[model samples]
Target: YEFDATVKKVEEAMLSEGFGVQLITGIHDMFKKKLGIDDYPKYTMVLGCKPQLAKRALETSLDMGLIFPCSFTIYEEDGKVKVAHVSIMKIGAEIGLADKEAMAPLIEDTGKQVRRVWDKI
Candidate 1:
């Protein structure tokens, strides 16, 4: 898929899954315009949020905010466009939270929604 088309699809999927795009950072363009390097592949990071989920997580532990606004990276590789994100399960485990029964559902739900966006595009 084309870059812009993929981006649009991702945005739509995120919204449909109850997440809102908080910001989009165009890494490729930044490097080109700032450093005059035009050889990089297209890449952008989508920062997203689901308000209720965020609120609950933060209420549980303020430190959780460090990973708030789940991020997905849209980039081109070998002439194909792909979307990638850190695994929420891994993140939770790393922070010693995934093992907690209460945290499992939230982590799973968030991962499901994020995967839905990737699959949609």
Candidate 2:
């Protein structure tokens, strides 16, 4: 039920945000075929980045490979699908940054985007 609920939330969010949904084969398919991660519904990461954020991030860092923008993955864990979110800013800080102010807004916005994504999930 949790997995189904999360999937539904994501679908509804995409629709509300006017983004298209791309459903790839579930992870179990690969497991049954190769890695043997069977019994779990694993799937490729669901990607949904707002155009505005994408544009801003690109303008901020031509190489802001850090903020490519993606969604938390949904996977079967302990017999349930769990949803999660990761932020580049969070990850970047762990690394090192010279300009914190310039990066602050980007990270803030990223956090907002993540929250919105979670709201849907």
Candidate 3:
């Protein structure tokens, strides 16, 4: 899929997965407006949240809310469109903020959800 199509697909997949489409930021457009640069490749950020899951994470640890919404960055590189996201649960564990054993199920479930979204995109 092209850049626009991929972005739309991601939004639809996320919504179908029961996540709220929070925000879609046009990074390249912002750079053109704020920095007066037109050479940057296309870049956008789509942020989504599964409120219940986020709430559960917070209940486990308030600090977990620091990165409440999950994000997927869509951009062009070497003329190829790319989509990517990071696992917030993994980040929290790696950074020693979340207990690995305690967040095991959440992480697994989140991975499954992400995988579904991936299969769609």
Candidate 4:
């Protein structure tokens, strides 16, 4: 898909999966205009969040906010648009959450929703 199309699809997908797009950063444009580097491929970062899930995680651990507003990167590479996101499960373990079991559902659900967003595109 083209860059704009992919971005639109991703935003729509996130909304359908109960995640709201909090922000989008146009890395390619920023680098080109600010740093005067125009050779970079198109790239954008999408920040999304589900309020209830965020609330639940916060209740479990204030530190969880560090990973709040999950991010997805959409970039053009090899003439194709690709999407990627950090693994919440890995983050949960990395932060050494005291209640992994309690956070498992939120982590898994968030990951699944992200997958759904990818699938939609």
Candidate 5:
């Protein structure tokens, strides 16, 4: 119930940010049977990709799949909509590629876009 309400909240927030939100709702069965997130509420992930920035990042590193687009997951936690981004900076650091100064700004910008979405919620 609250989870559904949260999607409305996120949708409103995304509209205010001038970014479109794509809600992935077809993975519930997979999550329950395969991923073992049975007790977890259905997950709604918003793919927030800025066109110019993403294109620039693509130009920067062809192998930059590690941080192509940013995503934030909204789920019910204690009857609240919890939004969180999957940080690519941390992933880059884990893989020892965080030192790429050229990619820093791109990654930061992606982070900012995702943050903007979360901020509105």
Candidate 6:
């Protein structure tokens, strides 16, 4: 997909997978205006969350709140568009923020949700 199409597709896919769209913003403008960088390609950040899942994770560990909103980055680099996501649940586990056994199911469910998002987009 092209830049705008990719952003739209990701928004629809995330909604279809039950994630609420928290924010969507172009990164190029921020970089250029705030940091005085002018040579960047198109970039967008998609912030999304399933509030129920976030609640559960936080109940398991308040520190999980640090990773509440999950995000996907879509950018153009080297004449190609790319999308990237790193699992917040897994990050919490690796960083010792979530209890291993307590968060296992949440991790599994969120992973499936992201898998569907990727598959659709």
| Top of the candidates by lDDT | 6
Error of 3 at 6 (Å): 0.8
Number of backbone-clashing residue pairs for each candidate, in the order shown: 0, 1, 0, 0, 0, 0
C-alpha TM-scores of all predictions: 0.85, 0.69, 0.96, 0.86, 0.66, 0.94
When 1 and 2 are scored with lDDT, the better candidate is: 1
What's the candidate order when arranged by decreasing lDDT? 6, 3, 4, 1, 5, 2
lDDT of each candidate versus the true structure: 0.78, 0.61, 0.89, 0.81, 0.63, 0.92
Span of ten consecutive residues with least summed lDDT in model 3:
89-98
Query: Model 1, 30-95: lDDT tens per residue?
Result: 999999999999999888888987876766566677767787789999999988888654585567
> Candidate 3 at 27: error in angstroms?
0.7
Q: Identify the superior model by TM-score, candidate 2 or candidate 5.
A: 2
Candidate that would win on TM-score: 3
| Residues 14-106, model 6: lDDT tens digits | 999999999999999899999999988999999999988899899889998887699999999889999999999889988999888888999
Candidate 3 ranges beyond 4 A from true positions:
none
**Model 6, which residues run further than 4 Å from truth?**
none
Give the alpha carbon lDDT tens digit for every residue of 3-49 in model 5.
Answer: 66766777777657765554445255568878887675667776655
State candidate 4's TM-score: 0.86
Of 3 and 6, the candidate ahead on lDDT is 6
Q: C-alpha displacement of 119 in model 1, angstroms?
A: 4.1
Instruction: Give the distance in Å from residue 32's predicted Cα in candidate 1 to where it truly belongs.
Output: 1.2
Model 2: per-residue Cα lDDT over 62-95, one tens digit each: 5555645455566777776676667756565445
